[model samples]
Target chain A: MEKVMAFTGDEIAAEAMRQINPDVLAAYPITPQTETVQKFSEFVAEGRVSTDMIRVESEHSAMSACVGAAAAGARAMTATSANGLALMWEIIYIAASYRLPIVMPVVNRALSGPINIHCDHSDSMGARDSGWIQLYSENCQEVYDNLIQALPIGEDRNVLLPVMVCFDGFIISHGTEGVAVLEDKVARNFIGEFKNIHSLLDIDNPVTYGPLDLFDYYFEHKRQQVEAMEKAPEVVKKVGKQFGELTGRFYGLLEDYHLQDADLVVIAAGSTAGTVKATVDELREEGVRAGLLKIRTFRPFPQKEIIQKLSKAKAVAVMDRSASFGAIGGPIFLEVRSALFEEQKKPLVISYIYGLGGRDTGINQIKQVYHDLAKAAQSGKVSQLVNYLGVRE
Target chain B: MKLKGWKDIPWGGLILEAGNAQKYETGGWRTFRPIWHEDKCKQCLFCWIYCPDGSVIVEDKKVKGFYYEHCKGCGICAQECPFEAITMEEESKFRKDQGGRP
Candidate 1:
């Protein structure tokens, strides 16, 4: 039987970690993400889980240790946020290149220049091309669910890649919410035991990892990574279905809310999806045909599904919590536009950069975005293709 | 072995062997070869200790001969020999006397 409990996103993520109880956990403390490791440490102290918690000196070493552990045929996991993720950038690529099947929970925070630690997508968005499967969560429940699903997806023989489960920094990480957690035996049974095809510890069959390929084979190795990424969606769906059967909560690449007959839709990710859904409900009550498409898996982006759903709308607004400076719009917007380019009948797609540096995205501000989308639907022209929401001009 | 294609290579370009230096034949790269004098009045083994590649063959604590298959003919052994027990000979000259070596 499942247990219902209230936990902050970080605490729930730690709960999921406790349930999975990976072989190794190498992590460093960074705000928002720190509590996850802290809570997991308490689990270790209480002797609840036998995870070999490695207190690494820095985020770089943390990820490096995870890489070493995973490569040595252990199921390894870690947690980080913002600059800690940035510090692990080099090894992040290495982890994927080696296909380590390590899972990490990333608390989404603003990357520094002004050095502010707050809710934003800049951290994970910056690593969109780092070759890891990225799963975004709307709240604590989803964070727990995503973490549970991440293991099977990444550890799938066909996928064999690292997974990043991201959620808004303070919004979800600090905010407490009710969640349904699976029993340890059932969760373990669902995840099963990790079986690495090639490991450094395989004594009989010796295999090499991270070799130097000048030009003779580098392209093909990269192509293999590409092929693995292409195979992820199917594996993700299958794993999600199995998890849903166990927990009674289904998941998909993207979540569609009231998009069936709506004329206008808003596309966003992470905790902002909850905000958009609320605004959509309020707008629907006012006789406005508003809908939402919340992206769950951002790495193997649900491009076809996004195009199919958004194609029915007369206008679409993509809200990005992170900015892509010097580009036409934010990362999510760019992907949404590119996905729509192949459609025979395209919607009036616009972008809104919002909620940067932990700025509040009130229901009123979200309603204003819906109003703008409705106006664009009526006029059939997007006067402003890209705009900033709630920013002091 | 020949690498047929990129697919033949392992992911992340890992070389698993502890020392694969033997797979590469360094002898062909030599412009000069080191020739050892059997009776140089001393067997100090300085050349064996200083050799970058473990090409120097030592038997019963005595300088035996060079494993020419792996030696690059860098002349380091000839230069490091304390009693001038080794000399660097031009490859062309050494080729003519190759029959004299075991």
Candidate 2:
């Protein structure tokens, strides 16, 4: 059974955690992510879940406790936003290197200097190379779905690495949306029991974990992690397929919105993808061959699928919500532009840095991108390699 | 033993087999090996308790010999021994034929 519940992105994420009912959940509260931890704590207080909720001192310990629990062969999860994620930096890599299969829901907030609490891609982007599988969510619905799917995806024997399911802080995190939540029993069955192969607590086996690996072995161990990362896309596809069957919504590494006949395509991730989708629909109604390629999985980047979906377009605009300092484009734009490099019939690609520090990326701005794409296509070239949207000059 | 390729190893350097540390002989890392003076020995087993690598050999509650295959020759047993029953010796002084306790 499925029920559509009105929940903010944070609330739906907590609702998913409640249903997962993991053996351990350790998290520290930070803006945009605090409500998720608070809601899960409410579940603990109400006896809704059997999870050992560790109200930790900081995000660092929260991630460390999760690493310990997961290494001990228990299902573990945690949630955090910008600065909190920054604090979990060292352990975040350890979780993946140790292959602990810890699941984390990261609310994407702008990293601080002159600090402000709001949505951006800086938090998760900073950990882009931390060896965790990254799933970017467009709205509350994807947040709920991704959190549920992250379990089987990370815990799969072929790909036992940590996973971070990312949704834009406050944009999706605080905004209300009607989300279809799976029945508790159905979700529980899908997640199933965590099958631990090499656990610290598996006393009969008496295994060692995270030992001081030196030059003789450290490189080889790291190579194995890369192999697992290379193997993850298949597991993600399989799990997403299985999840679609359970619920009614299908998912893949990326979503192609009318790309089959599109001459101009816009690429985006997170909440901006939703805005781009709306703009695509409006343009299509007005007889424009506009489309969108929404990135669902950002890490292990799904380059092949991205290339395929974007091949037919005459011009493509890659929108990134975070900036990459001293780079040609933002993170997603860099991947898309690089992926299209070798394609025989590749479209003219351009990059747009938008929505940094929670700025509103309105539908008009998305339409303006389509107009720029059309102009670029007409001129047989993109005037600028990179562009900025929804920001004052 | 040959070093296993990355593909041949476990996913994350997980030591799957218990007591497999015995297969990895760390004794070659030694520069200074320990010499046991059996004549001066009063075997209270302080050396047995103090050996970090469990290299101290004991039999019937008596001091036996060192397991040189696993000892890194840290000399903690010599330092902890109440009496000077054990002493440190440079490995250069010993030839293969004179490499004492197994």
Question: Against the true structure, whose TM-score is highest?
Answer: 2
Report the CA-based lDDT of candidate 2 relative to the real structure.
0.91
Interface RMSD of 1: 2.9
TM-score of chain A of 1: 0.99
Per-residue alpha-carbon lDDT of model 1 for A1-393, expressed as tens digits?
A: 888999999999999999999999999999989999999999999999999999999999999999999988999999999999999999999999898999999999999989989999999999999999999999999999999999999999889999999999999999999999898998888888998878889987677777666566677778888888999999988988887888788898999899999899999999989998999899899999999999999999888888888878999999999999999999999999998887889999999999999999989999999899889999889999999999998
Interface RMSD (C-alpha) of each candidate? 2.9, 1.1
DockQ of each: 0.40, 0.64
lDDT of 2 by residue, A274-393 (tens): 888889899999999999889888887998898888878899999988899999999988888889888889899999999888888899998999999999999998799888887778
**Against the hidden reference, what TM-scores do the models get?**
0.90, 0.94
Best by DockQ: 2
